[model samples]
Target chain A: DAGVTQSPTHLIKTRGQHVTLRCSPISGHKSVSWYQQVLGQGPQFIFQYYEKEERGRGNFPDRFSARQFPNYSSELNVNALLLGDSALYLCASSFYRGEGQPQHFGDGTRLSIL
Target chain B: AQSVTQPDIHITVSEGASLELRCNYSYGATPYLFWYVQSPGQGLQLLLKYFSGDTLVQGIKGFEAEFKRSQSSFNLRKPSVHWSDAAEYFCAVEDSGTYKYIFGTGTRLKVLA
Candidate 1:
């Protein structure tokens, strides 16, 4: 079974520009979460979606937003990108949004803000 | 507030030597703990987790972690290290009643020949 898949393995954008990173969860998975990993730092949770509903959100600013489609795929959108936004965006999928399931992650999209 | 801390930023150990990484968490309730490994330029992989029951949990790649609630720590250990064990290890904690998780800064393990 293929694990979570993310598109645009790498992306580059200028300040004030907007960008969208995509993710497709593993088959039969119902939960998807997004995280931002800055250089030399651990990933910070951005958003989590379960069953097409916004289940949880992190401390990220309003500029960061995400949504899950009916098919369980997810998209993370960022507006007015800043140089600090340059980081690896990771997508993780799990069977459910609970304590028992371990999230499976994608290779992630390396986003660079110029 | 929930938080996770990995005291060591980097560690180097000779191949075939024992290895241990430290993790500490701050939470009010019973915390769900997890260890994840990330290779260079790759996503994080689950090494193991502790939800309940046995405080000592075994994971893939011959890794194990002992959770100490009294000390609020979950430390990962391996009997012998290999070149393949070189990676960044992150310790995460999820609140028992919430879906959120807090990850530590991570410990970069370097295997020496």
Candidate 2:
């Protein structure tokens, strides 16, 4: 089966602008999570949704939000983009929100803020 | 809060030589440990994971990790280094209650020919 897929592999936005990144999890997966990776750093968790409900959240700012559809696909939304927000956004999926289920990742969407 | 630490920011190893990357995690409970590799301009690929059972767990790409509860370490190791292994490696931990992963800064491997 195809791994998790993310849309708009690359994106450019200006300050004060908003952007939305999409992700489709693997077939039969019911959990999706979002992460942001800056240069020279590991990915930081943003949000996690399971069964269309929010399950976990990281230390990201309020400007960042996410939602999951009934189909288990997800969208990460960021408002008032700043130059600091220019980073690669990653999406991961697992069979469920439980232990022993390693998440599978997508290539990620590179977001550039100007 | 749970966290992961990779002391070596970058490591250089000769091709065909053994390789080891250090990872230490801080968690009160038995956390799920994982190792992931990422090539330039790519997402992370799972190298291996350890949940329970034998402390030594094998993963894809000839990678293996040993979970040491006493040391709070889950260092990744490979029998022989390959040029293709010249990528960034990240160590992460997830608490059982919280499924979110806490990742280390990462270690960039440079394999010399």
Candidate 3:
């Protein structure tokens, strides 16, 4: 089976613009989560969805949002992008929510804000 | 409050040498622990995880980790290091009572040929 897949491997945007990143989870997986990895830092959780519902949200600003689809895929939307938002956006899929379930990740979408 | 810490920001090891990466966390209760490796320009791959039962867990890529509840630590180790193992390693813990993961800053390993 294919691993988690992400679209638009790379993206470029200017400040105040909007960007939408997409992710398709591994087949048969029902949980998808979003994370932001800054250069030289570990990934920071942004959002998590399970069964097409928002399960958890990180401490990101309101400008950042995400939603899960019926197919278990997910999209992360960022409005008013800032230079600080320039980072690698990663998507991870898991069999289910909770412990003992490992997450598989996609290559990630590198978003560059100019 | 909960957080993960990787004290070593960078480490250099010779190929065929033993390797160890340290990870420490601060939380009231024991939580799920994990080690992930990220190659340059790549997403993280699960190296290993410790949830329950065994204090020591073996993962893919010839990696293993030990969870010490008394030390609040879960450190990754490899019997023999390879050049391909040079990458950024992250330690994460399940956020208390949530599905979120709290990740440490990361340790970048540089393998010497």
Candidate with maximal DockQ: 2
What tens digits encode model 1's per-residue C-alpha lDDT throughout B1-113?
88999999999999999999999999887888999999999999999999989999999999999999999999999999999999999999885555766899999999999
Model 1 clash tally, residue pairs: 0
What does candidate 3's lDDT look like per residue over B1-113, in tens digits? 78999999999999999999999999887688899999999999998888889898999999999999999999999999999999999999888666788899999999999
What lDDT tens digits, residue by residue, belong to model 1 across residues A1-114? Answer: 999999999999999999999999999999999999998999998999999999898889999999999999999999999999999999999999888678889999999988
- State the displacement of the C-alpha of residue B58, model 2, in Å, after optimal TM-score superposition: 0.6
DockQ of each: 0.75, 0.86, 0.81
Clashing pairs in 2: none
Q: Write the per-residue lDDT of candidate 2 for residues B52-94, one digit (tens) a residue.
A: 8999999999999999999999999999999999999999998
lDDT of 2 at A76: 98
**How does each model score on TM-score?**
0.97, 0.98, 0.98
The residue ranges of model 3 lying beyond 4 angstroms of the native Cα positions read: none
